[model samples]
Target chain A: MIAENVAFGIIAAAMALGALGVVRTKNVVHAALYLVVVLAGGAAQFILLGQEFVAWVQVLVYIGAVIVLFLFGIMLTRAPMHPKDSLDNDLRWPAAVTALFLVGILVGLLVHTFHADKIHLNGPVRTADITNDIFTTYIIPFEVVGVLLLGALIGAVVLARKD
Target chain B: MLLNEFLILAAFLFCTGVYGVLARKHAVLVLMSVELMLAGVNINFVAFGAFHNDRIGQVFALFVLTIAAAEVGIGLAIVLLIYRNLHSADLDDVDTMKG
Candidate 1:
């Protein structure tokens, strides 16, 4: 239990700092790299919670595919690699305040509601079980997501194509 | 592990994403922030799924991941179009709809 607590603490701290870097960094490319840290930390968090499949999927999809897409987008857009003052606008302080307020409300409500609860993390959910649940109970949503992906693919191609 | 820890971490991540979305002037960065927010939600789903001993939560997170991928694809496409037209990826510059 103590080990779990410590592991969670280290990973969560890393994720928190990465999240901050993503928002606060002036270099757009560095922001993408920071996002990698946060996503990797998320995978570790999933592993700690005994969800290995989700963790790997996170690594494969988020770290592998999504970050690559972001880098491509950055390259195509030709955003400055060097730090610039125009990354943020006039609402920085207001945005920070709003975020802080949101965090306060969420943390307070969560603490109040689930202060006494504990997670067993005793065993990982079988991948077979997740697959079965998806095919049986979540069949419709699964199909819908497939269709959505196809639509997004076509839409992206059409939207990005030259006239 | 206490459930509150996971939930609190998720909330913090979500709010930080919110800050990025509101403060970032670049469209691509804004989309990245949205991904951050989705990741936070994904953690919540996985944590609760683990807590309840249900596989459905993991399934839900999977769906969220799929949707996030689709969103990024479509969003980046749109951003590319905007950049092509305006030669800038900054969100503050794309105000053609301002009446």
Candidate 2:
């Protein structure tokens, strides 16, 4: 239990720093790289939570597919590889204040409500059980998500095609 | 092991994403921030699910992953189109609809 707590603390701190880098970095590519840290940390968090399937899925989907897509967008759009000052808008201060406000409220509420609660990571979640749930209880949503993916694919091709 | 640990981490991530979305001038950066927010939500879901010993949270996290992928696909497509048209990826530069 102490080991798990230490692991979680380290990973969570790294993720927080990575998340900050994602938002605060001057270079777009650097921001993307920072995202990789946060994403990998998320996978670690999932493992610590005893959800191995989701952790690997996160690695495959977010780190693999999504980050690649972001790179393509960055390259195709020709974002400056070097750091720049104009990446932020004039509303930066206001946005930071808003985000800080949210942090105070959310963190306060969560600690107040769940401060004593502990997650019992008894055993790793079975991938087979997740599959069963998806196919049986969540069949409708699963199919809907499939349809959504198909639609998104078609829409992307259509929207990105040259006239 | 404390549930608040995960929840607080998620809240911090979510707020950072919000700041990114609101302050970033680039469209792709905004999309990336949105991804951050979704990731935070996924953490919350998985944490709650684990706390309760339920598989539903894992299932929902999978669904969130699928949807996030689709969203990135479509969002990048739109950003590409905008860049192609305006020759710029800055969100402020694409205000043709502004009165």
- Which candidate achieves the best DockQ against the true structure? 2
DockQ each? 0.92, 0.94
How far does residue B67 in candidate 2 sit from its true spot (Å)? 0.6
After superposing candidate 2 on the true structure, give the runs of residues whose Cα lies further than 4 Å from its correct spot.
Answer: A83-85
TM-score of 1: 0.98
Judged by DockQ cut-offs, the docking class of candidate 1 is high
Please write out the lDDT profile of model 1 over residues A1-163, one tens digit for every residue: 9999999999999999999999999899999999999999999999999898889999999999999999999999999887455699899999999999999999999999999899987687788888888899999999999999999999999999999
- The positional error of residue A146 in candidate 2, measured at the CA in angstroms, is 0.3
lDDT of 2 by residue, A1-163 (tens): 8899999999999999999999988899999999999999999999999999999999999999999999999999999877555799998999999999999999888878887998877799999999999999999999999999999999999999998
Worst 10 residues of 2 chain B by lDDT: B1-10
Tens-place lDDT per residue, model 1, B36-69, is 9999999999999999988878999999999999
